[model samples]
Target chain A: MTGALIAGIAAGLLAAVLHFAFVQSYILLGEQYETGELVHFQTPADHATEDHAAADQHDHGSHEHGDEPSVLQRNALTVGFTVLLYVAYGMLLTAGFAIASQFGRKITATEGALWGLAGFVAFQMAPGMGLAPELPGSAAADLTARQIWWWSTVVATGGGLALLAYGRSILTVVAGIVLLALPHVIGAPLLDAYYGYAPTEVGAIFSSRVLGVGLAVWVVLGWLAGRQWDRGAAA
Target chain B: MTTTTQTKTQSLLAPILGMAVIGLTVLLAVGHAQSATLHDAAHDMRHATGFPCH
Candidate 1:
C-alpha cells in the first residue's frame, strides 16, 4: 500500500505535467467557445470548407490571448488534485494486486503495467466509447443518467476484465465476456441531437488527446505501483 | 512461519478492500458527484481527467 501510494503520487505528478503540456490548452479553447468568446461556423456548409479552422483558433487561443497567468493558477490546484486522483487509483490497483497475490500469482512491473492497461480499458476506453471526453459547451445527456451509466460501465468492465484475467473455467470466461459487452449493449445515455459551441473538430481533438493522456498516466501508475509493491513484498 | 504468513495475508485482504472502497468513493465524489462550486473550482481538471462534466 505504501509503495502504491508513492508510485501513485509520482505518476500523478507525471499525469499533471503531461496534461498541462498536451490537454489544457484545448480545454481553455473549448471554454472560450462555451462562453461565446469564440464562435464557430454558423451553418453546416461553412463547416465543410474550413477543417483547419479549429486548429488555427486553438493556436491563437494558446498564444495571443496571454492565458498564461490563469493557466498557471489553475494548474497549481490541478497538480494537487491530479496527484490525489492517482493515489486513489493506486489504491485500486494495489487491491487488484493483493487479490492476485492471494491466488498465488506474483506481480511484476510488467504485469503491473497490464493491470494498469486494464484499468484504462475499464475506466476510460470502454466508457469513452459511448460518452467520450466532452468539451465545455458540448451538449450532454442528463448528468445523473450519464453518471449512472458511467459507473455501471466501469464496474462491469472492471469485473469482466478481472474474471477474464483470473478465471480458470470456460464458464467464468464467458461470464466475463458478457459483463464486458453488457454496458455497450445497453448503450450510454445520449442527447437526441448533436450540439456544442465549439467546432466538432475541436471537441474531437480534445477527446482523443484526453484518452491519450489517460493511457499514459494509467500505465505509468500501474508500473510504479507494481515495482513498489514487489519491492515491499520482497522485503 | 507458514501459519503466521497465512494469517498476515488473510488480515491484509480486509484492509485492502476497505481502502478500495474509500478510494472509489473519493473518485466518484470528485469526478461525478461534487457540487457546482467544486465543479467550478475543478473545472479544467474535471475535463482533463475525463470525468463526466457540464
Candidate 2:
C-alpha cells in the first residue's frame, strides 16, 4: 500500500534522526578507541604510550582499507543508509500487517506499537541475546558464521512470534514456541580468545544504547505504519 | 474494511513477497554485505543499530 511506503519513509527518517541524536557519539568514541586514539585497561606500571597495544586483532573480513574514512564528514551516507534500513523494516512490517488484515484480523494504530515491539523482539532482541552489539576493534566470531546465526535467529523469532500472535490452536502455538527457542538453544558463535581495543566500559554502554535506540525507533515505525494502514481501512 | 480498501488491495501474497524481498535486500546490503565500501559507508549505522560489525 502507498500507506506503508509513506510510513516506511517517515519512519526511516525518524530513525536516522534518533540515531544521530542518541547513538552517533558513542560510535565516534568507539572508533577513536578502535584506531588507537584512546586506550583501555591500562595500568600506570605498564603505561605504554604510543604503543598500538590494542593493535586491533579484530578480524574484519574484507574490511581492508588503504585510508581511514574521515569522521563526521559523511553525514549523507549515514543518513541515506539508515533511511534505507528503516524503509526495509517498514516494508517488512506492513507486509506482515497486510497479511494479517487479509486473514480478518484488523490492526489499529495503538496495536501497531505492540507490533513494533514484536519486531524488536524478532529482529533486535532475539539476535542480540546471541550477538551483543560490537564496537570497532572488538573481537567477534567469524563474520560468515555470525551472519548465518543472526539471520536464522531473526527469521525463527519472527515466524515464532507470528504464530503465537495469530494462531488459535494449541498445536500452532506449540510450534511457535519451538521456533522461538531453537536459535538460543543452538547458541551464537563466539570468539575463542577475547581481545579488543575498545574499553569494556565503552562497549557496555554502546551495546545497551544500541538496543534502546532500536526499541524506540521500531515502535515509532510500527505506529506510523499502522496508522496509515488504519487510515486506508477507514477510507 | 471498506469497499475502497478491498479494491485498493489485491491478493496479499504478491505484495507480501514483493515487499519482503525488497526489504530483505535493503537490510542485507546495509547490515550484512561483506564489501569494504559498504562497511565503510555504513560504519556508523552498522555499529549504532547493533548489526554484527568489526
Candidate 3:
C-alpha cells in the first residue's frame, strides 16, 4: 500500500510538471511574437478585455514580435510549484490503480489502458469543454454556442468516469446511467458557480469528442504503465 | 494421465477466458463513450494531444 501511494504521488508529480512546462512554453511562444512592451503579468479579470484592447492599440503585428525559441526558466519557484502539481496528479492516478490492484482480480495492460483513457476523458477533456473554466479572454468564452458544448463535455466526463470505475457489475452499470441522467434532471451547475454547466447539444457533442480523444491518450499511458508493472512482477 | 493434463489446461483457460470476456465488454463501453458528439475545435485540440479521436 505504501509503495503504491508513493508511486501514485511520484507519477502525478511527473505528469503535472510536464503539463505545466508545456503550458508555460505555449504562453512564451505568444509572448515572443510581441514587438512592443512585454506583458509580464495581469489578473484574469483585467486580462479578458483590457489587455486585448491594449495589445490591439499598439500596432505591433506578428513580425515585430520576433519568433524567439522559448527558454524554460530554470527558477526554483516555477519548477518547484509546477513539479509539485504534477506529483499530486500522479499520486492520484497511481493510488487509484493501487487500490484497484488490491482486489487481486487485477487488470491487464489493455484494461489499464482503458482505465487511463477513462481518466483523461472524464478529467481534463470533459471538464475543459464545459464545467472547467475557459481562458476568460478567448472568443470561446463569449460564444454561447461554444459554452453549451463545453458543459456537455463536463457531464459526459463525469458519467464516463463513474462507468469506468464500476462497469463490471450490473448494479454499477445502472448507477452510471443514473449518473448520466442527473445532468438532465438537475440541470447543469453540477458543482457550484465556478463549475456552472451550459445545457447545449453542441457543447455536449464537443465535450464528448474532446474527452474521447483524451481517453485514448490515457489508454496509451496506462498500457505503458501496465507493461512496466508486469515486468516488475515477472522479475 | 491425459484427463489430468486436460484438467490443468482447462484451469488456465478459465481465467484467461473470463478476463478476455470482461475486457471485451469494457472496450465496448469505452467505445460508446468515445463515439459521442464532439466540437471541431475541441476535436482538433484532442489531436494536438496526439490522440486518435475517431
Give the winner by DockQ: 1
Candidate 1, residues A1-235, lDDT tens digits: the string is 6887898899999998888778877776777677776678657675553454446544654434464446456667778778888888998899888888888999989999999999999989998998998888788998889889988999999999999998999999999999999999999999899777887777888899999999999999999999988988899
The Cα RMSD in angstroms, rounded to one decimal, for candidate 2 relative to the true structure is: 5.8
Query: DockQ of candidates 1 onward, in order?
Result: 0.69, 0.66, 0.04
Residue A120 of model 3 has an lDDT of 67
lDDT of 2 by residue, A1-235 (tens): 6776787778778878887666666666666677776667668644553233223212121223447554335667888888888888888888888878878888888878789999999989999899998877688998899889999999999999989988999998999999999999999998888988877776787788889889988999899989988998889
Ranking by TM-score: 1, 2, 3
Tens-digit lDDT track of model 3 for A153-232: 54565565657475798877777777555544544333222322222322333344434434544555556555555454
Model 1 Cα displacement at A103 (Å)? 1.2
**RMSD (CA, Å), each prediction:** 3.3, 5.8, 14.0
Better structure of 1 and 2 per DockQ: 1
After TM-score superposition, the amount by which residue A229's alpha carbon in candidate 2 deviates from its true location, in angstroms, is 0.8
| Runs in model 3 lying further than 4 Å from the true structure | A1-83, A136-169, A181-217, B1-54
The top-ranked prediction according to TM-score is 1
Full ranking by DockQ: 1, 2, 3
Residue B8 in candidate 2, Cα distance off native in Å: 10
- State iRMS for model 2: 1.6
